[model samples]
Target: MEGKPEDDGGDLTRRGFLGGTGAALVVAGVPTLGGVGVEEEGVSTQLLEAVPQTAIRVTVNGTEHRVEVEDRWTLNEFLRDHIGLTGSKIGCNRGECGACTVLLDGEPVYSCSTLAVWADGREIVTVEGLERGGDVSPLQQAFMDHNAAQCGFCTPGQLMTATALLDRIPQPTTGEVREAMVGNLCRCSNYNAIVEAVLAAAATSGSGGAQ
Candidate 1:
């Protein structure tokens, strides 16, 4: 009696029907594209959710600028785009050309490579900030007088770097000036004029003669 079969075909049919219904329900719950289950939606949403907006306040040339930027926005973009200070050229954009150089707390720094958020609460000085009472700085005047600028694309960065150097050294020798200006490059190959301008500025400042 214990081993005898019940011969319940109805029971077997019910079990198979239940199993098929469960499988259909599972298929219905899953997302499908062209009759195939796809997992792209969740991934895209996750990626979008991961991005964050950043806010920072930067003081440039004695002016405070408040901007909302993404985490990846660079200081160069903030200066050129938001603040409308485009003197810092976007050459190379990887900190190689030194064309995007600016002063941060009186120290020369590459704007292209520096993050905007990193400059929060810090003082930034650009080439546009070098003018005094509608007149250019002494270094800028010397550059013009000596004809140190050709093409003039890299002049702003050069001026900033030179300004920082002179601020520190006051009187820099030709060799020292050359060493200090190593970061800036001129496509016109106007190194002689550039050096002359720096020397002239030193003389005007009464910082002694070039060594």
Candidate 2:
């Protein structure tokens, strides 16, 4: 029988030999003909090539914020972590719950679902921005007056939605308020009071009846 392939001093098989050689080449910092490094860590290091962090400028509630964030960061992260504005609650982070609602360019958007990069150079409005000169907005007053909130988890989102509705329909009918706030779920089952609150706010603000 052909002499058993000369046993290497070590248990190194042909595949193992090639693997170790590749790893050594990689660690040696050798560049391959393919213009890539031979080592795994070398490849990873090359791929990571420290890029300068991107700087994002966003206007939140009329205040400008210059923040450095990764491309993957979400608007919710920017709002809660970067700016210290945490009034917008994070319920189901997947955008199913309206708890993280905020206004972007005058439209209600789910901050959790929106990427921070996408919000760059845009105006954002959060619950904390609703007050004027430290006075609560009429919608907020209406919520309290009508006992529209309980447990208070969904109130921020409710207020934001109500603000948007009133901006569009100053005097929303009871049915219109219900339809507009459909996305916001109140675990407290305070829909009746919430509707009343919105209608009251519309009348107070002189928005006229809902279309």
Residues 173-192 of candidate 2 have per-residue lDDT tens digits of 78888898888888888889
Candidate 2 clash figure, as a count = 3
Candidate 1: global Cα-lDDT? 0.79
> Which candidate wins on TM-score?
1
Regions of model 1 farther than 4 Å from truth: 1-51, 206-211
In angstroms, give how far residue 5 of model 1 lies from its true place: 97
**Per-residue lDDT over 1-211 for candidate 1, one digit per residue giving the tens place of the 0 to 100 score:** 1222347544555435544566687477444312432347546332123334477787888788787765777899888765668789988899887889999988899999988888888889999898877878888889999999999999999888888888888888899999998999898889899989988988797432111
Name the runs in model 2 displaced over 4 angstroms.
Answer: 1-53, 207-211
Error of 2 at 184 (Å): 0.9
Report RMSD (Å) for each prediction in the order shown.
Answer: 24.0, 17.7
Report how far residue 99 has shifted in candidate 2, in Å: 0.7
* Candidate no. 1 TM-score: 0.74
